[model samples]
Target chain A: MGTRDRIVAAADQVINELGLVRATTREIARAAGCSEALLYKHFSRKEDLFLAVLLERMPALTPAVTRLSGQVGFATVAENLEEFARAAIAFYRRSLPLSAGLLAERSLLEGFRAMLAETGGGPHLPIMMLGTYLRDEQKIGRVGADADPDAAAALLMGACFHRAVLAALVDLGPDDKAPGFVATLMAGLGPR
Target chain B: MGTRDRIVAAADQVINELGLVRATTREIARAAGCSEALLYKHFSRKEDLFLAVLLERMPALTPAVTRLSGQVGFATVAENLEEFARAAIAFYRRSLPLSAGLLAERSLLEGFRAMLAETGGGPHLPIMMLGTYLRDEQKIGRVGADADPDAAAALLMGACFHRAVLAALVDLGPDDKAPGFVATLMAGLGPR
Candidate 1:
């Protein structure tokens, strides 16, 4: 619709076609039916443009963050956790393969990480949210008193993300493992 | 070493600098102190060279698989699982960053998947082996009978891999979470 949207869309296409290494700004500009100068008017750098594409294209973890925030005390601890994990798993399944294009390119990943660091963010955003929720559960005596919330949160998110990776790379199909996995993960950690 | 090893090492270097997209065969050959013809004689395609690099450079899961095989009947189930997870985590920490190069390129990744298929292997081989070990544990009444060995295996490996990704991308440093995480994971699974 707009030039900016068109440029971003074109960048996405070029990335999908040639991978991140070959998706030059010139190629992206050509795809957008614009001059390179025009493309630079919207974004200062190629990494900036790539960042826009990534943020716009990848599913945001914010909605789940919001849901976890609201469900802190009301739901069963296991229920709250399993649901949160399910949301993460779904997001990873969709984004993992697509995000490979960036992962393969060192500079793009570094730029992305720098951008994250500037924003006081990193990949652990989801883990932190889950940690907060788990801490709340521990406080209220829903989860085990001895359980380390940070480690539990990391373990939960890590497993979900890993499962997503398997689904993407190994043709593992849609996740039928979550319910059992969650139960296995949660079995020993209930209030004692 | 020999020409084959030299070529693969050169590919590793070029890939580290330029990522997969820009690491052309010409560049790799130049770096390897060999003619492109000599390089081709050693490896037919770029993907093959990269695979050789991956196989040589990245940590093989085979040793851990062997360790688990022998430990099935001897060690405490929790101890065995934690050690296996540590090995997986250590491997991921080394390989995850290097893997970004593959994730960036579509054809390269597809080529990789095809190669794995030909070898009757995929990334989840370790998970499957661990699952077998856990099943052995279940049969002997060491772990909970209700636990899904496959899911448990997936969860263990998945969590370790995700943590490695974080360490590489998010500056998460060394993993201080594993001991507590493993404890939480094994809490209810032990024989009473």
Candidate 2:
């Protein structure tokens, strides 16, 4: 692997273990088997390196969008929603520790925000994407005409996001409600 | 206020401004106009002082429970859920920064976790309480038999929690979806 890749991997590992503050550049360099000076040569500061790590490690949304698009008209709406929920839940679980660390540091948080702004990213984008998918289902008469797509998306994604948060705070097990929950929602959403 | 109360207030203010690591004992004591020794005497450590402030300032659940209990049979289910969502969202908004600060530090996070365990507290207790309320509504033919009360509770609480998390990450504004969101969920949950 390239020096940059190794360094980024090392930083991710160290940060997950020791958190952002204690995941010193020195430890990251040692783990990457490079000199600390070499680490600085590649990335001027820890924050820059952390950003690199995030782009590489944070789950990309493109595949998920494509997957959901394919399911809207082709699959049963419940099956599609369940598949979407699994992907969203897994992404959130991976995202928690990474984001909590960045949000805890104001400087890092500002830098991260700047990047998102430059990329035209908004936090609500995911919810909007999910809403779009629900709208497609609605068009096909799979979802109730009375249901607000955005609110339904929020309800589903919100549950997944919140579950991840609680898991971070304390050990929480799977609720075994995924299948049942989707079934119930679909029952209400199906044509009246 | 008493010396102890004064010290606690100063510590809360400093911690909120400077975060957990930078809120030094001396700084807090100076802000409180008390000797560092007296601060220590009142609270053995900063964590203890933090806990006191949390109890005093954090949004309490008593009022919410009382309000919800009164609404079980009287108000429309939609009204009760909307009212509950408002309270949960407000509490989560207030709690985001405080918990993020503590979670940033491993030692402090462990200390806080230990305290929760000793107090016989679980993160899902509030959700469970909401579930119980829904079950009662189900008994009265308000909620659909198909909707799992626990899952319904998770859905509502999860959205509020997730919204708070996103707001903490970046600037998020009032969604104005609370009322509509509750209405949509109730439509799906109403007897089919």
Best by DockQ: 1
Residue pair clashes in candidate 1? A100-B103, A104-B100, A104-B104
Candidate 2 stretches with Cα past 4 Å from truth are A24-26, A35-48, A58-62, A174-177, A187-192, B24-26, B35-37, B40-42, B45-48, B189-192
User: Model 1: per-residue lDDT, tens digit, B82-165?
Assistant: 777788888886666456566656777778677767777667888898889888877777777777777677777777888877
A82-192 in candidate 2: lDDT tens per residue?
877877777777766666677666666677777666766655688888889888888878777777788777888888877776676666766655665566555542123
lDDT of 1 by residue, A1-192 (tens): 999999998987888788777888999999999999999999887868877776676566668778887886786766776777887887776556445555666777787778767876767878888888777777777777776677777777888888777665567756466566667776742222
Report the alpha-carbon TM-score of model 2 versus the true structure: 0.87
Give the TM-score, chain B only, in order for the candidates: 0.85, 0.83
Backbone clashes in candidate 1 total 3
TM-score of chain A, every prediction, order shown:
0.82, 0.81
Instruction: Give the DockQ (2 decimals) of all models.
Output: 0.47, 0.45
Q: C-alpha displacement of A75 in model 2, angstroms?
A: 3.1
